[model samples]
Target: MKVLVTGGSGFIASWIRKELAARGHSVLVMDHQDRRQNLAPDEEFFLGDVRDATAVTEAAAHVDGIIHLAAVLGTQETISNPRPSAETNILGSLNVFEAAAQYGLPVVYAGVGNHAFRLVGTGCYTITKSAAEDLARMYNLYRDGGRITIVRPVNAYGPGQSIAKPYGTSKVRKILPALTCRALIGSPIEVYGDGTQISDCVYVEDVARAFVTALEHTAVNGPTEKPVEVGPLTSVTVNDIAAMVAGHAAAVTGRPVVDLVHLPMRPGEIPNAVVSSDTSTLQQIGMTAADFVPLAEGIRRTVDYYATQWLPGWLQGMQVSA
Candidate 1:
C-alpha cells in the first residue's frame, strides 16, 4: 500500500515511515519539514501543514490509506496557545477525515494515552485529542464503509526524539529530553511537585510498529470505537524516570551521578498519566514482551543518542543558569 502520512516529519511519523517500508509499503509524507534522506524510491514528500485543507486534500489524494499523525503537540504548548492548537489538532483532523471519507480510504489515527481506564489529563492537548478521537468515531459512524483505527500511545521516547523546541506559544517539555539535557552534564534533573506523577512511556520504534500492525489489521478488525492502547505494561513515576535516566547517563557516558530537584507543578498538569488496564493493542497485534525494548535498554539507547548526536550541539547553545 502507498500511505499518506500526515505529520510525517515529526518524531513518531519518522519511525512509521520506516515501518511502512519494512512492511513492503510506500509513503507520501505531508509535514512542515522536508525529510528526504533514506526514503524509499517510491516514498514521496508534500511539504505542507495539516491546517491547510487544500493542501491536505492534495496530499490525501491517490493514497491507498491515511495515517493521521499530525497535530499541535504538547500539553503545555497547546494550553498556552489554544487557538492554533484547535485549528490544527481539531480542524486539521476534520480535513483528513473528510478526505478519507471522500476517497473511501481507511484511516489509522494517533491518539493520546488511553481513556478506557482514566483520562490522562485535563489540558488543551488532552481535550483536543479527545475531541479529534470523537470526530474520528463520528466519521466512522456517518460515512458508510469508512474505517478508522486509533492508536493511543503514551509519552513516546527514543533516538529521533528532539529536545524541547519552540512549539506554539510555549516551548515543548518532553520528559526524556529535559532529563537528558541535565543528566548528560551531571546536573540535577528537575522534578516537579514531589516527583510522584506517573507516566507510561514507549519507545518510538515500538509505537511505530504498533501503528503499522493496526493499519495492516484494521481491515479485519474494522473501526472499533475503543482505541488501541499502545505502550508499556508498567507505569513509572517522575521520580523513577529521573533515577533511571541519571543511572544511564553515568553508565553510558561516564557522567557523574545526578540528583533530582523538586519544583512546583506546571498549571493544567495531571498527577498521573498512565495506560488503561484494558488489553493494549500491542498485545492484539501479537507483540510479546520480547518485542518491546526493555525500559532500561530504551533509556540507554536514548542516552547514547543524546550523549553523541544531541549533547554536542546542545552544549554549544546551552546558556548557564543564573
Candidate 2:
C-alpha cells in the first residue's frame, strides 16, 4: 500500500513513518523544511508548507490513503497568533482533505480532544481544530470516492514527544514542582495553576499505529454501516501523568521531584477534559485500547527520549526568571 503521512518530521509522525515503513508499505512524508533535520532514511521526505495547495496536492498524488497530522498545535501559540494558526491548521488542513477528495482516497483526520468541549482560554486553537474536524466530516458526507474518520487523541506522550517544546503540554500545575524535584532542569518548570486538573494521554507510537490501522481496515468508511472508530485509546489524569514523568525523570537522571507550588491557573481552561469513543464501533475493526502501552512505560520512554534528543536544546532555550 502507498501512504502519505503529513507532518512526518514531527515527533509523533516520525514514528508513524517508521511504523508504516515497517509494515511493508511505501511511505512518503510531507513536513516543513525547518523540521527536516530528524528525517529518517526510509521515508521519501517532501519539504513544503501545507498551506500551499500545489505542494500538498503533489504529495497527495502518490499515495493511496492519507493520515493528516500537520497542524499548528498549541493553545498558547495558537491563541497568541490566531490568524496564522487558523490559516495553517484550519485552512491548510482543508487543502489536504481537498486533495484527498480530488484523488479519491480515504483520510484519517487528527482532531483534538479539547475541542470536544467548550474551554474558555484556548478558544482560538480549539475552534480552529474543531472546524477542521468538521471539514473532514463534511467532505466525507458529501464528497465522492473517499472516507473520513476523525481521531481525537487526548494528551499523547511517547518516545518522539518533548516536554520542553512550547506548543503542547499537560496543563497540570504540579509538573514543574515534580520536575524541580527531579532536577531535570536548572530552573523550575513552569506551572500555570493549582495542578489538580485532570486530562488523558495516549502513546504516540500507539496513535501512529492506529493511523495506519485506520487505513488498513475497510470499516473506517462505509454506506452499509456507520464509520468504524479505530482504537488503542486511553485516558489518564494530568497530575498522575506529572507524577509519572517526575518519577521517571528521577530514576533516569537521579533527582527527586519537589512539591508543586501554587500558581494562578490559566484563564478559560477546562478543569477536566475527556473524550468518548464508540468502543463497539472500534471493536468492529478489531481495535482496542488494551493494545496501548501503559502510562508508566510510555512516560519512561518519553523522558528518556527527551533527555537524549530534545532536552539539550530545550534547556538551552530557557532563561532564569528574574
Candidate 3:
C-alpha cells in the first residue's frame, strides 16, 4: 500500500513512517517542513499546509490511504493563541477529511486519550482536538463511502521527543523531555501543581506501531463509533517521573539526584490518577500495555539519546526557566 502521512516530520510520525516502510508499504509525506532524514528510500514528500484543501487533495491523489497527524500541539501554545490553534487543528483537519472524502481514501485520524477521562480547566487544546474528531465522524457519516479510523493516544514519549521551539514569549512545556533535560544538568525538576497528576505514557515506537496496526485492521472502520485507545496501562505520577529521570541521570552521568520543585499548575490541567482504555479494542489490533517499553528503560534510553543528540543544544538554552 502507498500511504500518505500528514505531519510525517513529527516525532511520532517519523517512527510511523519507518514502521510502514518496514512493512513494505510506500509512504508519501505531506508536511510544511522537510525531514528527508526520516524518509525511506521509496518514500516521497509533498510540502504544504494541511489547512489548504488543494494542497491536501494534491498530496492524497496517489496514496492508497491517509494517516492524518498534522496539528499545532501543546497546551500552552493552544491556550495562548486559540485562533491559530483552531484554524490549524480544526480547519486543517477538515481539509484532510474533505480531501480524503473527495478521493474516497481511508483515513486514520489521531486523537487525545485524555478526553476519555475527566477533564479540568479551560481545555483549549481539547476543544480544538474534539472538534476535529467530530469533523472526522461527520465526514465519515456524510461522505457515506469514506472510511475514517480514529485512534486516541495517551502521553507518548521516547527518544526524539523534544520541546517545541519557543513561539514568541510562551515557552513550550512537554513533560518528559523537559524533566530529562533538567535532570541531566543537575537543575531542579519542576512539577506543576502538587506533582500528583498521573499520565499513561506510551513509548513513541509503540504508539507508532499502534497507528500502523489501526491502519491495517479492518474493524477500525467497522460500525463502532468509539476510537481505539492505545497506550501503556500503567500510570505514573509527575513526581514518580521526576524521580525516574533523576535516577537515570545519576546513573548515566554520575550526577547527584535532582530536586523536585513544586510550581503552580497551569490552566486546563487535570489530575489524572489512572487511565482506562478499551482493552478489547486494543486486543483486536494485537497490542497491549505489556508490549510497551518499561518506564525505567524508556526513560534511560531517552536520557541517553538526548545526552548524545540533544543535550548540548538543550544546555545552551537551559538558562531559560521551566
Candidate 4:
C-alpha cells in the first residue's frame, strides 16, 4: 500500500513511516517541516502544509491512503491563541477528509487521547480534534470507496525529542521531553498543582503499530468502524513521571538529575485529570496493554536519548560549573 503520512516528520509519524516501510508500504510525506535525516531513502517528502487545500489535494493525488497526523498540539498554548490551531487542526483535517473522499482513500487519523477532556473544555486542541473526529464519522457514513480510522494516542514518548519543534506545536514543552531536558541540564522539573494529574504514556513504537493495524485492516471498498484508542491500562501521575526521569538519569549518568518544584496549573489546562482510554478497538485487533512498553522502561530509553543527544553540551557546562 502506498500511504501519505501528514506531519510525517514529527516524532510519532517518524515511527509510523518506519512501520509502514517495514510492512512494504510506499510512503509520501506532506509537512511544513523540512526532511529529517532518519527517513527511509525511498520515502518521498513534500514540503507543504495541510492548511493549503491545493497542496493537500496535490499530495493526496498519488497516494493509496492517508495517515493524517498534522495538527497544532499544545494545551495551554492552543487555549491562549486558537486561530492558527483551529485553522490547522480543523481546517487542515477538513482538507484531508475532502481529498480522501474525492480520491476514495482510507485515512488513519491521529487524534488526541485527551479528547474526553472536551467535556471540561481543556483547550482548543480537544475542541478542534473532537470536531474533526465527528467529521470523520460523518464522512464515513457517506464517503465513497474509502474508510477513516481514528487513533487517539495519549502521551507518546521515546528517543529523539527536542525543542527544535517548538517543544517538539506537533508541541509546547511536552511533558516527557520537557522533564528530560530539565533533568539533563540539572534544571528544576516543574510540577503543576502537586503533579497529581494523571497521564497515560505509550511508547512511540506501539502507537505506530496501532496505526499500521488500522491501515492494514482498512477496507478499500468502504468505511470501517475503527476508532483505535492507544493507551496503557495503568495510569501514572505527572509527579511519578518526573521522579522516574530524575531517578533514571541519576542512575545512568551518575549526575544530579534535579529536583521537582510545585507550581500552579497553567491556564486552559485540566487539573487532577485521570485519563484512561477505551482500548476495545485496539483489543479487537489483538493489541492490548500487555504489548505496551513499560512506562519506566520507555522513560529510561527517552532519558538516554536526550542524554546522548545533549551530553556533550551538558559535560561542558558541568565542567564550567565545577
Q: Against the true structure, whose TM-score is highest?
A: 4
For candidate 3, write residues 70-185 as lDDT tens digits: 98877766777888778888999998888877877878889877764324454567688878888888877777655788888887889877564331122556778888777877
lDDT of 1 by residue, 242-300 (tens): 89999989887676788899998786665554443244545665654356787888998
TM-score of each: 0.90, 0.82, 0.90, 0.92
Alpha carbon lDDT of each predicted model: 0.79, 0.66, 0.78, 0.82
- Residue-level lDDT tens digits of model 2 in 197-279: 65656677877777677777633444213344433345445555666766667666665663444456564465554443444
lDDT of 1: 0.79
Tens-digit lDDT track of model 4 for 58-150: 999999999999989877888889998899999999999999888888888888888888887688978998899998998888666447888
For model 4, the stretches where C-alpha displacement exceeds 4 angstroms are 36-38, 164-171, 220-226, 317-322
lDDT of 1 at 305: 87
Question: Residue 287 error for model 3, in Å?
Answer: 2.2
In order, how many clashes per candidate?
A: 0, 7, 0, 0
Candidate 2: residue pairs that collide: 121-268, 173-195, 181-256, 181-257, 181-258, 182-256, 200-236
In model 1, which runs have C-alpha deviations exceeding 4 angstroms? 33-41, 114-121, 165-170, 272-277, 288-290, 316-322
Residue 39 CA displacement from its true place in model 2, Å: 3.1
Q: Candidate 1, after superposition: displacement of residue 140 in Å? A: 1.6
